[model samples]
Target: MKADVVFINGEVLTVDKHNSRQQAVAVKENVIAAVGTNDDIKSYIGEQTEVIDLEGKSLVPGFIDSHVHLTIYGTNLLGVSCIESHIHSLEDIFTDLRKKAEETPKGEWVRAWGFDQLEINEQRFPTREELDQISTEHPILVIRTCNHMCIANSKALEIANMDEHTPDPEGGIIERDDNGQLTGKLIENAHMQMFKVASYSSEELSISMKLASDAFIKEGITSIHDAGAYGKGSETLRIMQQAVRNKDIRVRVYAIMGSLTNSHDFVHQMVQAGTVTGLGDYYFKLGPVKLFTDGSSTGPTIATRQPYTSDPKNSGIIYYSQEDLDCYLGNAHKKGFQITAHAQGDRSIEMLLDCIEKALKEYPRNDHRHRIEHAGIASPDLQQRMKELEVIPIPNPVFMYVNGDVYKEYYGERINVMYPARDYQEQGIVAAFGSDAPVTFVNPLLGIHAAVNRKSKTGQEVGEQQKVDVLEALRCYTINGAFASFDEERKGSIEAGKLADLVVLSESLLTIDSARIKDLGVELTMVDGQVLFKNEQLMRPSGVRR
Candidate 1:
């Protein structure tokens, strides 16, 4: 009955059912008690109630990244160069690698990520010989931005005991030279073998998870859906559970367990253990069963309908066969588990759509809300079917900015068709926006800009025709993201009875120029009637409730 906090004198983009705008919002405990004019909100402002003046800052729901690699992003936060280094030539990469190798202990593994050969205008992956020249004693591994591939130094390969005779694992590739020598490039599932050999300890995982949680809080992200947690067993899930239990995880997590060989059995056990989706409090929840249909376009490994323009000989590989995908989806659907398939290329998306269609026909369920993560290149037919089937498309707009050049080089004039955002919207499909963090920075503003602009980070227009408006982009990050996760009724908007998970921004996104949208900063972030973050200079009211 009493108000815990009242935010006044602000332009509130409520994103409510009526898409209403309000001047004030009153919060009681954690849920929003009232949303109206300042006069209407005054009744709830008791003497004990904390009142904060926004000074006309724009308030919206707290940004939710539907897809992110939380633990991996946290681990990369402590890694060496390559991401920040502008590798003009292979020598520049080598120089940085040598420096990192020198700093690392002699026998300790040297790890790095976010390297692109295209950035350096290289035609091939860096060989083990080049890395061996730097340090034969230290095991070195660098993961590509796509995460589908990695370049391991000879020492790392030796440590894994991977040789030319090592057969490529199912659903993966171990690139070998024409002379039948290992070229240090591991793709898809094969990368897992080496990674398992060089896996981090539980202590290291805990540190990384904590670091990532801290970063998420700083970024004003109250919740995130970790795309997939990889490894044998539910180690990542257990680590997250422990963090939440210890009160170390400041941000809530929805962890999607990666598909396993024994997924049916594992999922059955998880269900029996009461690990169903949406089973936990705000701290954590068991999410969808993640299945990868193909690799990434950054490596030109997304199984496209046509051969890649850059590599005519390759049309990308399908990680899961149709039969395997159907089996996984059918079983998961029957178990009432939502499925989030990583489908990028047209062929991959087509296959996933087919599998979903078959699943729907065989075992129909209402409001399935199964998602196609990174539905990058959906055809018109697929888009229409996605609407009819109620499939969610969680697209990464930041990918347009981060990998626009790669798409340009790989698809040439067909790049517009690659990420058809406008087409999806026109077809009435629910296209949610996400950053796919660690693949890109976790900035919702940047993603909004990219979605509305379709421009590369270098300020070049990649797909101007595919751009949406600012409001539509905002909806994607807010309401649409919530819809994808089936939390729209409880969160996402600044409506009465909804949880007060809101963000106050320094600049009004609606009034800002589209070109400068990415420059907007969060002035405050509040979750559950609590001020989680406020600008350093801003003073909070005394005697605020914990």
Candidate 2:
């Protein structure tokens, strides 16, 4: 009965199927030895074992991020800051750009991210004419926080040879001023044109992936679903594959393959090569083939059925036609590959649902569990169909706090149904939550707060009725996330024989003020019976198991 470690005298919120609670947990090697009272668990401890006394603190399953771009996060850390902390006005953006521009060698491409025009002083997008002033010599590209749109200077436009004569790609737009001149803003696939001008080096990609893994350990995120992995054709896959071989993957990852244009081709490649989900072990695994049907919710590219309230003439953009999606996703589904799509607007969601329905009827597979990422804005009919078709909705509640006002501006009264967590739960549909990091912070606690609060940056409630309790919100991040990734049996909950991956919090979220939940800190994080992070200030002194 001896164990490697024992966490004793703690309030353990075992997010088990039965919703059980325990006072102690014993770990033997990489699995949970037992979950029981402090006295009972002590029986499994040995003299050489490490014992931690929780002192009534909170211990729960480690957070599993359902979606994230770790490589992008690492690269963004190295990029220039353009968020609110660095810029509250267009002037601040220019100032930051000017600094970076001065340091860069003339003609090289200068890149940055996390800029939101809604938060800037000008309260509008900066024109290409304005960007020319920042750097007429170097190609400057500043991506918005949404990552669905970006602004490029004259040099960048010239470098890519984008002009009025250059027509917009099928799923994107090249914004122009009233005079029919390039405004330097590229929406959706139009931003892909920049790839021809600038591409990230393999070293840059590897460095960022490592940096991102380290950051996840500190954040108590034990697992992540890399939503897009094959951008450069097996390059992303090889990077993570090498990470696992070198033990650089600090956290478990389920990488979803990225496709440039045709998802059908990507799936055909996988099926032909005998590549299927769960191809790897616990540390690294191949996940679903991810495809995008639309763009970001906070941005103007979500592809709605109705025009935006703020910009009445624009109804947003849908990236794929119904016939096109069916051809791609239907083929993938027929080949036994699960699909997770990014669809933010109602029309796009409808498109995916229709395709999924047709695929199931034609292929006749059960437990397909195909997911809809961001599923940000759904119609009542869409929700009902999601339930009937067994489609999983993976939504990021943090967007409510980060861009709630912008969502409200575009949605108007339709904001009532935006991110409807309570509805999903009550309707017997399993919904998972994610941070969609690099778009927003990767803090799961903040995600929980956003779900329970449903409040905006200014503390305005976007949808009071949509709020879920703290535990349900927690389940969405942990168990439901595990379910989404098909790892519920080994991870997710604290139960006997389960993986010893857990997080210790400074306060009990159940008893704390809802507002303070977001402020709570992770004191310790354990993966496979090893402590990865321990905050000395919050952890108690070691104790003898006896």
Residue-pair clashes per candidate: 0, 1
For model 2, which pairs clash?
A: 230-258
- Model 1 scores what on Cα lDDT? 0.79
Q: What overall lDDT goes with each candidate model?
A: 0.79, 0.83
In candidate 2, stretches whose alpha carbon ends up further than 4 angstroms from where it belongs are 229-233, 259-272, 540-546
Deviation (Å) of 195 in candidate 2: 2.8
Tens digit of per-residue lDDT, candidate 1, span 230-317:
4543776788789878867767677776632333344545545655567777667777877778888787788888888898888887
Could you tell me which residue pairs clash in candidate 1? none
lDDT of 2 by residue, 1-546 (tens): 798888888889898977777899999999998999988887887888788888787889989999887777777876787875757888887888888889988997677788887777788887788889988998888888877788999899988889988999878889887888888999877875565455567777788888888898888899898875324636767887788678777788888765533434565677667787778988898888767788778777888888888898988887778998888788778888888788888888899999999999999998898999888877688899999999999989998988888778888977778878988988988998888888998989999999999998799889878999998998998999899888999999999988999999888878899988889999888988888888787665663334
What stretches of model 1 exceed 4 Å from their correct place? 85-106, 121-124, 259-275, 537-546
Candidate 2 residue-wise lDDT at 533: 85
Candidate closest to the true structure, highest lDDT: 2
Number of the top-ranking candidate, with TM-score as the measure? 2
lDDT of 2 at 134: 84
The ten-residue window of minimal lDDT in model 2 covers 258-267
